[model samples]
Target: MRLAIANLHASLGGARVLRDLTLTLEGNHFIGLIGPNGVGKTTLIRAIAGLIPFEGAITLDAAPIASIPPRTRARQIAYLAQGAESHWPLSVTRLVALGRLPHLEPFRKPQAEDEAAIARAMQLADVETMRTRDVLTLSGGERARVLLARALAVEAPLLLVDEPVAALDPYHQIGVMEGLVAYARAGRMVIAVLHDLSLAARYCDRLVMLNDGNVFADGAPADVLTPANLREVYRVNAEVTGEGRAMTVRPTGQI
Candidate 1:
């Protein structure tokens, strides 16, 4: 499966946020979107998910995503918005099971397959222990994980997650990234907006660096995370160490 975005433009509150942006996203890999704040990473993700209106075309499998019905679109793409919240005080399992809505029949009970998918998603997100707990009662990190479990439960062809690890501890951060990487390796597409450069470099198959609402660089982590690009775009000094699968990026200081 493929996702194609062309000449996309978006605005918020009469302020232009995304400019003429175009990119083609392919499946079976973990893609990381990274940039400084207010660069339109969230806008771009929302546009692709058809959650926000844009002035350009976005297509899935050569068909315009805008024309697809909401339920069908939900089946093709699973989105986890940044700072996502649940106000209903639902149990973790019930909330995560909501991912199956795209596949469920009206007024129908969950089938065995739905239960299995929910279980697998919770296991991948390390939220199975909290299955019966109320989502509102959980800590920020725990809630984040459960929300991720909800997204993963969809098992869609494409996963669009915005800053999935932002509130997690070091251990859970690693855990979430590892789960996403494994998910992509299992032949699905995972595009995530990540602020942590080191984690992005360590886990992403490709990195798209955005600046001024446009793609500044898109390539392997080592290629795009150069010290020169860092200074120019991020206004920081950084060092890239290690090679191949073992890589670490350390930000030295401001430029």
Candidate 2:
């Protein structure tokens, strides 16, 4: 699958948040969208998910995503919002089952295929042990994993997640990131908005660096995460060590 965004512009409360943004994304790799706060990473994900109105064009596999019916679009893209929370006290399995909504008939119970999908998603997210627990009762990190399990249940061709590892300990953070990367390597598209520069550099196959509502750099981690770019956009002193997937990012101080 391919997502094409051209000349995209978005406004929030009469203020332009994304300015002439454009990019094309293909499946089968983990893509990270990184930028300073208020640079429109969240807005960009919203636009791509068809959750907001935007100017210019966004298409999936040559068809305008805006023109696709909501149900069909839902099947094409699975979106996980930033810091997602569940208000209902639904069981974790029940919550994860919601991802199959687009595939099921109204008022229908989950079919065998849906059951398989839910179980697979839970296994991948390492939330199977908590399947019977109430989502509201889980800890911050546990809830994050369950929500991620819900998103993964969709098994959509394209996955757009906002901060999939926001509230987890370092262990689970790396675990979730590894799961996302493995998901992409299994031939799914995973695009996430990540604030942790080191993790983004280490996991993402490509990094799209945004600044002031524009793409400042787009390429391999080594090329885009330069000391100069970090100083200018992130206002941090950082360095990259090693190479390839084994690379590590170390931040020394503020610029």
Candidate 3:
């Protein structure tokens, strides 16, 4: 499956957040979206998930996502939002199981397959130990992984995650990123918004850098994360090093 965004634009409170953005993501690809704050990365993800009204075309497997209802879209696309909050005291397992709701008949109970999916998702996210814990009682990193598990439980071919590792410790951050890489390798399209440039360079198959509501750069990490691009878009000077599957990025100074 391929996820394609064409001529996309989004506005909030009469302010345009995304302008004429377009991109394509194929299955088995891990794409990283990066930019300075307030560049519309989150808004792009939300627009693709149909959580906001936007003028554009978002297609999954060549089918226009805008033509589908939110519930229908949920079955094909899974989204893990940045700073997601759970007000209710739902158990971890129960929260993950909610991903199956889109597939169940109205008022239908969880079947054997649903239970298996939730269990698998929990195991993959390394949150099986927290399965029975109250979601509100978990740490920030734990909660983020749990929410990721919930999204995985949907088994959607297209996964959109916004700043998925923002609150994680270094170890857990790498763990979660590797998990997403594995997911993409297993024939799913994974798109993640990230602030850490090094991790994005290491784990993502491609990079899309946004600036001022437009795509500033899009291509392989080496091409998009160059010193020149970083200086121009992020207003910083940085040295990008490493070779042959290993990359390191360090900020040298303000531009």
Candidate 4:
């Protein structure tokens, strides 16, 4: 699926968060969204997922997403939001099964296919061991993985994740990134909002940098993460190193 955002603008509680933002994500591309805190990265993800209203157009494979209902959109685009809450004591397996609701008949219970999808999602997210555990009892990282499993259970072609690795350790972070990469390799599109520049540069096929409600940079990591861009957009002194496929970022000081 090809996802495109055109002239997109969004505001929340009378505060504008996005301004004429536009981008295109071809299927099988792992695109990274990066910026300083409160730069509307999350808002962009939410708008794309149809979780919030916005101005302009979002299309999946040239089909206008705005014309689709929220439920239909949920089936097409699965979202894993940052710091998403799960207060209820739903079991991990059961929680993951919720992803199938969009495909189920009203009031119908999950079938064999749903179970298989849940299992597959758990395996993909490396959360199989926590299947029967109470979600409230899991650690932050564990819970994040479980939520990611839930999103995977949806089996959408477009995945939107907001800071999915924020609570994870280095090992789990890599694991999750690998899972997303694998998904994209399987002809899906993954858009992730990331704070860690090094990880974004390493994992993403392309990068989008937002500043003050607009796109500051959009291109390959090397082009968008230049020292000048880092200083001007992020207000930080940083060094970008590596040649070809081994690039890395190091922040020297706050500006």
lDDT of 1 by residue, 1-255 (tens): 898989999998889998999999886999999999999999999998988889989999999998999999998899999999888889999999999999998999999999999998998899988889999999999999999999999999999999999999999999999999988887899999999999999999999999998899999999999999999889999888986567877889997
Tell how far residue 68 is off in model 3, in angstroms: 1.7
lDDT of each: 0.93, 0.92, 0.89, 0.90
**How do the residues 1-255 of candidate 4 rate in per-residue lDDT, one tens digit apiece?**
888899999999999999998888786889999999988999999888888999999898898987887788878889998988688899999888888888788999988988888888888889988888999999989999999989989888899999989999999998998888887887788999999999999889999999998899999999999999999998999999994347889999999
**Residue pairs with backbone overlap in model 3:** none
Model 4's TM-score against the true structure: 0.94
Sequence-dependent TM-score of model 2: 0.97
Write the residue-wise lDDT of candidate 3 on 1-255 in tens digits: 888889999998999999999888775889999999999999998887888999979887788887877787888899998988777899999999988999899989999999998987887788998888999999988998999999989988889999999999999898888888888888888889999999999999999999999899998899899999999998999999994258988999996
TM-score head-to-head 3 vs 4, winner: 3
| lDDT tens readout by residue for model 2, 125-239 | 8899989999999998999999999899998989999999989899999889988987788788999999988899889999999999989999999999898999999998887
